[model samples]
Each structure stands twice: as structure tokens, then as C-alpha cells.
Target: MDSLFLVLPLLLSASFPHFTSAHNTAPPPCHFQAIFNFGDSNSDTGGLSAAFGQAAPPNGETFFHRPVGRYCDGRLVVDFIAKSLGLPYLSAFLDALGSNFSHGANFATAGSTIRPQNTTLHQSGFSPISLNVQWYEFNDFQRRSKIIRERGGVFRDLLPKEDAFSRGLYTFDIGQNDLTSGYFLNMTPGEVKAYIPDVISQFIAVIKDLYNHGARSFWIHNTGPAGCLPYVLTKVPVTAGQIDKYGCASPFNEVARHFNVKLKSAVAKLRRSLPKAALTYVDIYSIKLNLFQNATRHGFEHPLRACCGHGGKYNWNKDHGCGSTVTVKGRQVVVGKSCKDPSKAVVWDGVHFTEAANKFIFDRIVNGDYSDPPVPLRFACYRH
Candidate 1:
């Protein structure tokens, strides 16, 4: 008995290092079969200005060499998330221009928001497909996938169990435009705050509704620091010496933080209410802050200024936009200039992040030790 006890302890000691190492290792990569994205320009793949002639440049110029409707030069958060999950880049659902749905489709539109009234710099009217409408489009995709499967088509086997409740990832990155709309409409910040909770409630309800429709894993982004955005800063100017250390408008950033807090609480409530649902909050505010703090580390000279547009001091004017003409040093030159390499820049346009910034945010989400109570959506359905 004495000999056996000693051997047992030795065996445990021998295995202890291995066990510790295993525990310290990163979790296995999440293998998502499909990625469904719904949101505004931040996550939009290409769901705006296609029907109309209006276009934004430096948008999709990095990859597709032409405007692809995405508000950035290339690849938004949705694209990065999809790529991280080893899925194909999501195509725009409105892009009947193409017929590929193997990976998934992006239903996000530039200027789309959870609230009904949303606008952009161009004053482009609100998205044709609102949040509710995007949900309907998602349902349509599922229905079409089902029909294809019933026909024993190529994607038949790709569909998750219609009733098995296998969770797929759904990303929501809206609401900035809602606040922007309110601000543009001359509504007080307090009035905007009053109306935001209901917007959040409606958002949560839609997410829960999606859960009923077989979505089990949800990743929702809290609003980014909106006051820091060039458009807002320029439109709603502060006193000459009142800029924060970050050069952001304090009131607007405070509103954004307020929304993020409420959103975090809402997500927590969601986890409690739906024990089986794995919902995670992507802390975009923190990510944005980190990017700003480490701008030089990321190769950005000016985190606040954009690379494109005239004056070359701030962002290009909303009316003139990037890639337009202006006078520079007595020479008439095309004012909107794209950087030699966009990957190094923090802000691609006046509003959105560069593709590199988006990639960094994705890395932070997957790798950062986030404190904001993650519900572990990837592990929710795993059986040890």
C-alpha cells in the first residue's frame, strides 16, 4: 500500500506539467459553417448605392480595384470574422450582381441602423433593408437553403440541422447611425439616450427571434467612440481648446460609452434569459481606444486624420469627399489621396477603420483576455 501511494504521487507529479500546459494553451479554433452579418457601414459588405449612382471611393479599392459598396477601402469586420472562422468572404445579398452563396451573404447596408431613421454624409436616404428587413432576408436565405437541400443540391449537406439547434455565428454592428441621425435632427443628447434603450430592446428582440429561427451564437458590437469619428467632430465642433486628450468630442464619446454599458447589461440579461444561447459582446469601444493609444505602433502617423481628401490636415470635406479635386500649394491637384499602403493607416475614410485596423480588432476579440463577461458562444454547444 505504501509503495502504491508513492507511485501514484509520482505519476501525478509527472503528469502535472502536461496538464498545466494543456490548460494554458489557446482554445481550438471555432469552425463556423456560415456567417450572417447585419449592420451599418462598419460591417457592411456592399448593400448601398448599387441601385443608385452614388459611390464612395477608396472603398474596396484595396482588393476589388473599384467600389464594392463597402464603406471602407476593403474588408470590414464581417469579412475579417468570416475569414477568421475559415469561411469565404460574405457576398452582398443585394449583389444579384453575383451568384455565390457557398460561404454566406452580407445583408448589412451602409447607413443602416437598428433605429428607423439613419443617414450618412451624402444624406443618402436610409437603407432599403432596415434591421427588420435584414432579418427577413436571413429567413429567406435559410428557406432557400432548405429548398436547395430538399432537392439534394450542392448545398444540401452544408445546411445545419433545421431542428437540431446547431448554433451559427451572427454579427450585429449597427446603431451608430441611429445616434448620428438623432444628432443631425437636432435632438438633444438626453433625448437620444431616452430613445436608445427601446432601440436596444428591439435589437435584442430581433436577436431572440433569430435564435428561434436557429441562430444560437451571436456576436454584437457595442457602438464605437462616435465623437472621435471625423465626420461628427467636424460637423459638431467643440470650443477651440475643449478637445479631449484623444481629440474626441467628450459629449459624443460619453453617449457612446453609455450605449455600450447598456448594451453590455442587455447582453448579460440575454445570456441569463437564454441559457442555451451563447451571446457575446464585442467591445468595439475598447478596441477603438487601443488602436488610438497604439497608433504609432500600428504605423499610423495621425489616428484622427484620414489619408484621403483636401486640406490634408483633417478628413476630406463631406461634400467633396475623398478622391476629389482641390488646390494644394498653388497647384490644382486631386485632393483625395490614398496612402502608399492602407494597412498602416488607422482611419481609411473619415469614419471607418482601415482593413488592417479591422484585422487588429478581430485579433483582439479572438486573442485579448476580455473582462466583459464573455458568454463563450463557441463553447456553448461543445460537449466535453
Candidate 2:
């Protein structure tokens, strides 16, 4: 079955993409101190649950050993980036209990979108923390930080104040939902295609807003190969010819490629416009695909199937997904199941990658091969 994970690289293939791997990374580039991350599930550390209080087990099972609201089984790409920069793990902006956001704050959330609502594109709605809302939150954080500084309180732990924001790395890892949500929202292909311009415009607006707010270094990630995701493949219609040699849907991958192309073009235009900013466009798809191309090299035995979820070819049953529940008799019961070795699987659930896979990705990202303009995090991006 095309959707089966129950049934699912080598030589660093040049035909795919080029990424240089250096064991020793460079000093954090440009003396950037802190990192403020903004995105969806891919980079969210704990914002989703903090905002909604809707976390479940098997989420952080492989790493944190508890549900920390992360969609993955462990730390995300931003987590790895933090570690590579010798900085503390970014604390979610909404996690107030025992976290200190001195290093920086994460403003990402699961199911987030760049646009609040693109009705012309038939977007159903927007996550509470859309890109616009996140920007507003950043402004609010700045306001609060300033107030604390004046009050003679130790407020630096809350967020970056004034000059601190200038040297920080503002990372944007969003837009996957914009490209994939329309499929679930029942939007037409032409509607989806037409929506791209608005998406790019809204994205650019934030980059400029951050620049206006004293942000200098920018780390932007292009969307991943959504067509190859277990969640998309299980629900979307896929013909035999649509399935590639690697078991991914060819048409969907093509759509994702098109999105990347446009995203790259948008970044290029931004580069021309924001000449003072040291911006880096990350090719998230190719590095992730490299894991699939050389699965064994990265200790991955299954790249398409998930390590957790209910019964299905990909181990993903929409009705009883990783965090879903089922009513048994008169009581609600958790029906989601998980594999023994999540570290060996490429995916943790149907939509996100496993911690091991994220680590592999961070290795390549820090090495500076998948980024546009190729500023290796080793020497180009430093922490506070």
C-alpha cells in the first residue's frame, strides 16, 4: 500500500543537492547573541500546549519522557540549533512555570499560518498565534522588557531589550500549514496556487517588521517536502504512477518543489531589498530528503512510517492518532500506540520527524550546506 509505513542513502548524492560537512563548526557568525524563533510545529518547543493546554502522551516520549506539547518525539530543529550555538534550549514564550527566556524566546505554535485568514484561498481560519499575531507579541515582549528594565527588576530573563534584539538571530520556520492546509480545507488547486503571492507578501512583511524592530540576522527555512509526509500521503489520493521509487507521492513532491522555488525567489527579492540584513534561507526539504536518500547512514530504518500512532499502514489512524482518544463503552480511552524504537524511525508521528532525524538535520544545517548564501552556523551565528 502506498500509505503503508509497515512496508518502508548513500554517497551524499550530488544529483540531489550539495551540502558540505565540516566536523568543526565556525565561531557563531557575526557575534549574534540570542535566538528568537517563530514558526509552527516544526520549530515549536512548547508553545502549542502552553497556549491551549492540550498536550498528550507519546509526544515527547523518546526524549523528554513526557508530553511537552512538541509535535515531535523529542527536541526540534531549533533545539539542535540552540545546542550547536552553545546556548540554552529556547523557552516557549507562553511557558511561564519554571522557564527563563534569557537566551531568547520561542514564539512558534503548532498549526500556525503566515496569513490569518486567506478566504480568497479558502483558508478555514488561523491559529491563535499566526505570523501577524506573533509579530504583535514580539512588540509586546519588547514593551514589557523595557518596563521591567526601568522598574529596576531583573527583566532581562523575559526577552531581549533594545540593543539585544539587534544582535539576535530571528528565525522564521513557517508556511508548511499554508501549503498543506488547503488540501484538508477543501480548497481547489487553482485557489491554492493563487494564494502563494499573499503568503509571500505576508512573510516579507514580517521580515521587514523585524528589521524595523532592530533585528539584524535572519534565519529563514523553506518548507519541507509535504508530499512525502505520512499524514498527507495517508489521506490524499495517490495513484500507482504517483508513487516514486522511495514510496513518496511524486505529484506531491513536485508541488512541494514548486513551493520551494517560489519561496527561494521570494527570499532573493528580500535579499535585494534588505541589503543590510545578514539573511540565510534554509533548504529544509533537501536535508530532510537526504535522510531518506541515505536512511541507513543516519541509523534510520523507516523513513515514511511513523514511530507512534494507531493502526494503519503508516501507523497513523486519523481517528486514533498520536494524541487522539476513543470512547470505549462509557469511558474515553487513549487509543494511540507507539513503536518501541522511535529513534530509528524518521517520523515520530505522522507529520513530524523523530528527534534523531532532527539531530541529523541540525548536523547538516550547522555545517552550512543546505542554506542559501551558505553562512555556516558554525562561525556565522553565535549565541548570547
- Candidate with the greatest TM-score versus the true structure: 2
The whole-model C-alpha lDDT of candidate 1 against the native structure comes to 0.70
lDDT of each: 0.70, 0.76
- Candidate 2 lands at a TM-score of 0.86
How far out, in Å, is residue 352 in model 2? 0.7
Q: Which ranges in model 1 have alpha carbons more than 4 Å from their true place?
A: 1-29, 53-56, 118-125, 149-165, 324-334, 374-384
Tens digit per residue, CA lDDT, model 1, 227-337: 777777776656756578877777787888888888889988887887667676778888887787678986666888876555535665776666676678898766576
- What's the count of clashing pairs in each model shown? 2, 13
**Model 1 CA lDDT for position 310:** 51
Model 2 score (lDDT)? 0.76
